[model samples]
Target chain A: MSKLSARSEDYLKAILRLQDQKKVVRVKDLAQLLGVRSPTVVGVVSGLKEGGLVDQEHYGYISLTPEGKVVAETLLQNEELLRTFFEEVLNLDSGEATQNACNVEHFITPRCRERLVSFIRFLEICGRGAPKWLDHFRHFSLTGEPPPCDRCGEIFPGDRRGCEKA
Target chain B: MSKLSARSEDYLKAILRLQDQKKVVRVKDLAQLLGVRSPTVVGVVSGLKEGGLVDQEHYGYISLTPEGKVVAETLLQNEELLRTFFEEVLNLDSGEATQNACNVEHFITPRCRERLVSFIRFLEICGRGAPKWLDHFRHFSLTGEPPPCDRCGEIFPGDRRGCEKA
Candidate 1:
């Protein structure tokens, strides 16, 4: 995570997307995708090349190095996971999920994501055994009242009950 | 998407997490949870209050307004979905899935997420009825080549060949 900035990750992801579509990507293509100037793309690409994350041929085309592909794949996988989560469990509109996934992907820690995944699996299993799980979730939505405490199994009424032992 | 910065969203999310535990969140607690100075929490709380996203008492205890609760719930739901996709479908390590989910939650589009969710459902169905579908997918692990194009019904060989139609 410390190795790349959000901007650099975007650049790598853009390159990966373009490379998937075509044999190579150009600076202009990256500029268009990133909404940045060609010079900015060039600088980023140069930085990527120096970092051994990308390979460029005569400035005409760009591609990810094997290492770069690994990072890109990691990012892509994360993006897909976020997309699935928003669509399936929360029932948010799809366009909103995509937009949110794009924004949230840069800041998550590995450990937090793992716990979230486990929670999701728990939901999926619950969903499979009882379609009413979603209904139950909806019935007990986290709104004016707080949902049951995950750790203590106590339901707090209204919006602001102080839990001394939470 | 432009309505909130990632940092702001994070604050909202942190607030929501604390709400889940304590029902009522205090500025000092938020500052500690967020690893920021109390002044920073104060500033964000003020902004949230102005935006009608939170209700704060004179003592600095805070809880989300209805609108704020909705936003936080939505964000949390997205995070959960991403976690599911990365952990279950992609078989990523839980930590990686969670980290990825945090980043991916903000970018996923509703349409893409719907397709992904339906696809996951379809895969589950296929897994139950036709083990071959699951087997085939398993055969094409990340280390292996990309699987056959669903449209062309032909296995892609290497990177350059059999991908033109894909």
Candidate 2:
């Protein structure tokens, strides 16, 4: 598949979100959701239509093609995974996690995204009720000092760059 | 700071990388690095110059302004952090990690980047010489069955979506 620009992907995602919430999508709704002018939405939607990712009525409602739906779902899945990682693991506020996830979603490749999914699952399992590193990360974020690793003799702040070698 | 398009950020990063390796940045070099035509590089560089992010000596050599250098460094740092995470923690091949990191760097916010840095440090300290989850992730990638998390009773493939609750 050809790579779409990040902005174009954002448009696809917004269209999907608007459709889900309102059960219909229009140029005005897309513009409002994306915080852009109506003309910009019109232009991008027309481009998406030409690319066979969307369909539109005669100057009316917009809808995703099957291909577009797949693209939107993938983007949404990535955003959700990242948001969950940031909020649950990193302990970021929900708003910050949502914003960061939105910003970062377009960049993750399918291959990398698969690994991320598995990694998230790993964390979920390991983090349930044991000596979870997720909590350790949250503590480090709060106190700028990472908890010591008994496995490795190197202290975190003291070793700093040398930690990479460990 | 005004937001630049992903394209613009890519251009800035390309120029910085070319300058670091070749000691000079020309339109052709940028075209080759970005896999775009010289005309595209010229157009983008012109916009960069207009935006006060770059300086071109009579349409010959291109160099970044001080402001542009700051932007480039931030992008570079994000890429490095991601590349290291992918390669070191996730065990992706170096080339794949670098490529994915380049694609994803511009989207990470500064605050998120700081957390990532700390997270990497935490992993380095905790993962060394131990039954590290980093190695466990590589195992999951290969076997497709995640190593069990004794704390949670959820098995990965069987409880795909429900793993989140675990």
Candidate 3:
């Protein structure tokens, strides 16, 4: 199948979320959730129907085809993962993280996503009770420079570049 | 200014790169570089001209206005940072990193960009001679489980969950 546009993916994801929250989804529900008009929802839903991504039945109730469900679920997963990474690992505020995740979810590739999952997992395991290096990282973020110890050859003797390696 | 479409940003970035490499830019050169046709370039260039992002004069030679150059430069920097993060921090192959970087750069926000910068800087500083946690991460990636030491209460005493902290 061809890749769905970001707008289409948003519709799919919104539809899936509505499906999760309620038994029946109407045009107005999706439109309200997406902050668009009913006519706009009608137009996009028809396109999605043509694309085999959704089914409209029973007086405007919307349902996802199996493939559509899969696509929507994947995008939802990507969005959640990005939100977690941004909020937990990147330490951005919840709103900032949500916004960034929404922007990035469609664009991040599967390989990058896999790597991200692993990075988070690594932190979960290796950072039990929060590792000391994490504090060092926080310091670096605040100062825009590595701390005095991580800067020189102290950590790795004879590697003189220190924090200036870049 | 309003946000440019991804297509418009592509045109602007392509112009910047071509400008960096040579003195003059034509629609054909842009089309060749972008692997699109000249007519498409002409159409988009007209829109960009109206937006004050570019100028087409002296037989189709293209030049970015100051604002256009700033926008293009920011996009270029975002792309490079993403490429470096994917390649160095994520350990993705060069080609995969480049492809993901290209897909992600336009959508990433300035705040998210700052976090990514800090993350890379953290790695550069704290990961001198490769942190052991990163090695554990590599192991986790290959085996889909943290190593024995990380899985128990060894790293952090009384923490029985160990690698299962998630």
Candidate 4:
């Protein structure tokens, strides 16, 4: 997971994405995808090839090695997972979700990733029915008042005994 | 915002932290806080002094310029905000919360920071009574089944309509 810098990781990701979209990955395609010049792409690609993370054929076509594929796939999956969590759970918009996910994809540890996975799975499954307190959350976010939950009133006294603290 | 690298930003933060904690900051103290050598801290402090972000007395004590204090305070506040959000909202462990906040404090944009603030303030105020869905979330996180919210059954026809999707 820590094998390469974020820039190199992005190169691998762009290669995989371009491969699916265009069916052939070229050095120029990578440069365009990454918004870099051809020479910069050439330089990074050479380093990637030397690291055994990419294979370059005669015509400047770039493909991931098996090791590279695994790394890229892990990174891509992490990005998707983070984006989905940001969108669904955190209620971030599409642009913010994508940007935040990209910013965070390279940094999440395996433990944090698992915890996020658990958190999102819980939200996706539980929130399908849209519980009543979820509405209070919206109301609170908008109006600064939650209007007091009857159930919580019954469940606990003052100071909110059962809920976890920050 | 884009003026300094993350390493440089950390230097500013450590100087501020040391200033408040020690009342006197030294090159060696900065090295300890940043986990770099004294010479490395000296080099960065020189750059920071030239950049008008830090002042070094003849002996060794380091102090922040007014501009530097503003930047450092902002970063420290952002770090605390992120740490609190991770702890309260995400329910992460203390170690994980601190680790993740440190990893992300430098990268969040002003817009994202505002959104995070709003989200956290909502939770802090609204979740005070420990609403029903909060328990359901805990239960679902633990048991993988929400036990079906009765209120949701009446409100939602099939797929949840009111709740925002990720």
Q: Which regions of candidate 1 are displaced past 4 Å?
A: A9-33, A36-166, B126-166
> Each predicted model: what fraction of the native A–B Cα contacts (within 8 Å) does it retain?
0.10, 0.27, 0.37, 0.24
Weakest lDDT window of 10 consecutive positions for candidate 1 chain B: B151-160
Model 1: per-residue Cα lDDT over B101-158, one tens digit each: 7766665566555555554554353233222333333344432433343422121111
Candidate 4 — which pairs collide? A87-B166, A88-B166
Q: Candidate order by DockQ, highest to lowest?
A: 3, 4, 2, 1
Across B42-129, the per-residue lDDT of candidate 2 in tens digits comes to: 9989999988899998867999999998998878878889899878876778998998888778776777778878888876655444
> Candidates' lDDT values, in order?
0.65, 0.76, 0.78, 0.73
Instruction: Give the alpha carbon lDDT tens digit for every residue of A1-166 in model 1.
Output: 2399888998999999998997679999999998999999999989999999999877468889999999998987777676566656555567777666666667777654554455455444323322333433333332322233331212111112243333
What C-alpha RMSD separates each model from the true structure? Answer: 14.7, 6.0, 4.8, 5.5
Clashes of each: 34, 0, 0, 2
**lDDT, model 4, position B87:** 72
- Model 1: CAPRI class: incorrect
Q: For model 3, what is the C-alpha lDDT against the true structure?
A: 0.78
> How well is each residue in A80-144 modelled by candidate 2, as lDDT tens digits?
99898778866778999999889878776677778877777766654444434565678877897
Tens digit per residue, CA lDDT, model 4, A1-166: 3478878888999998997788889888899889999999999988899998889976757898899888889889998998896665556788988888887787766767876787777655555553444454445556766445433432221135453321
By TM-score, the better pick of 2 and 3 is 3
Residue A74, candidate 2: Cα error in Å is: 2.8
Question: TM-score winner among the candidates?
Answer: 3
Clashing residue pairs for model 3:
none
* Candidate numbers, best lDDT first, in rank order: 3, 2, 4, 1
> Which portions of model 2 miss their true places by more than 4 Å?
A1-4, A148-166, B1-3, B50-53, B65-67, B148-166
For candidate 1, chain B by itself scores a TM value of 0.72
